[model samples]
Target chain A: MFKELIGKRSAPSKNVIERGAVKKFAEAINDPAPIYIDEKAGKASRYGRNIAPPTFPITLEYGAIEELVLPTKGLIHGEQKFHYKRPLFVGEEVYGVTEIKNYYERTGSFGKMGFLVIERQGTDAQGELIFTEEQIIIINEAARKGMPV
Target chain B: MTAMTEIKVGESLEQMQMPPVTRLDLIKYAGASGDFNPIHTIDEEATNAGLPGIIAHGMWTMGNLAKLFTPYVEDGFIEDYAIRFRNMVFIDDVLTLQAVLYKEEENKREFKVAVVNQKGQEVVNGTVVFRMYEVGMAG
Candidate 1:
């Protein structure tokens, strides 16, 4: 159903990797790693600053595509993958954009399901690639029934 | 710090047993992650959506799964992570994270990772590749 969105890319959105947000995120996950919270530890570490958790990008805002619409309540996050060239420092600005990679339907135990694949890319101010996150959202029959065809 | 030489490809890492999932935990995660999806925090909304009360965000489970590598953070950082949500995680469901070394290289180690509920059913499973710091390198 979302096939028309394939190859569509959104405008770049800005995100600042704030330290307080990083600390809160680290605590929320119950990880007390000093490198993520302690400035001294971070300075001592190779990265020269506090680094964000691997999955911290989930908190960043990605630009939106006008045509992308799905029920937020019933969709399942089926799969996720993140590849980082280097960890994000606590105080850096990243510009991120997302592209609809592919879309398809499958019949699982829950009946007809839709799989929407999107790729988000984050780059530094110089436009250097920092990380890439690919995610698959699963739309069950119930959720798909609510979407616009 | 985990010495690179001591890692064994066939051995399992120490498992992390998390406290039972709580509404407060989900609320805190929702705020921290900027994912305020009500289905993860509101029972009524979840029921209206045909769910069995509130469910945990798959990212929450995925974030917790990365805790398995925290102990080795000083040794290296997680360079790549991939996971599939195998089942829904509900409130009060006790989760445990486990990882077994599946591959070891000169500068990286790979692990087969999983998170299971109290009944031992896998809720999420994936692989993580950790890029190790060169020996004798200062951090």
Candidate 2:
């Protein structure tokens, strides 16, 4: 069912790497690193400014591809990977887009499951590539059956 | 502080013992990450979805793994990270984070990292590649 959606890309979404959001994310994860929260410490650090956590991109909005839809519950985050050219600085603006890389199904202990692979990229205002995130989401039989018709 | 020179392949980084997972943690993470996935924060929703109860977001657990490297910010930053979710983490589960240096290069280091539940079963495992700053290099 998801085969037709392979290679589909979403419209670019704009995201501002806000300081407040960064701080909340950092705290939510229980990481109190000065570079992420303290402005003075950020200035003293090598980056010379507050930077978002490596996984902070999860908080950014990646516009949805109209044809791609999955259940809101029971989907499993099977795997994830991140590659970064540089950390995103607070107050910087970046554009993000997601593409459906592939999709397949397999029978496992949990019964038949669908694996959906998607990749998201973030670019700075100058159009420089900042980071890429690839993830595989597992749709168990129950979740697959619950998908909207 | 661990200097770049002192890091040795085959050595273990200091392990971090995180407090038990809590519902409040998931709630805060949902608000911060904008994931708002009901399975992660609502017990009834999770049960209906076939889960035992509410569970932590995999991203929430993955995000905390970065804490193991915060001490080395001056030496370098994580250039790459990859992981698989081996198991679901439930509220009240105590997680211990550990990493071992597996490869070392002139300007980079690689570590195999894992987060194990209190039972010592790995719930997540992966690798992190840290890119180092050159001697006297400015940020």
**Number of the top-ranking candidate, with DockQ as the measure:** 2
The sequence of per-residue lDDT tens digits that candidate 1 reaches over residues A8-126 is: 99999999999999999998888869989999999998778899989999899889999998776567788999998887889999999999999999997878988999999999999
B5-99 per-residue lDDT for model 1 (tens digits): 58799988888899999999899999999889898999988887778889898998999889878777667888899999999899989999998
TM-score of chain B of 1: 0.92
For candidate 2, write residues A1-149 as lDDT tens digits: 78899999999999999999999999999997998999999999998999989889998988999988788766789999999898789999999999999999999787898999999999999999999999999888777788531
Give the chain B TM-score for each candidate: 0.92, 0.94
Worst 10 residues of 2 chain A by lDDT: A140-149
TM-scores for every predicted model: 0.94, 0.95
Model 1 lDDT at residue A140: 80
The candidate 1 chain B region of ten consecutive residues with least summed lDDT is B130-139
Q: After superposition, how far is residue A124 of candidate 2 from its true place, in Å?
A: 0.3
Candidate 1 Cα RMSD after full superposition onto the native fold (Å): 2.6
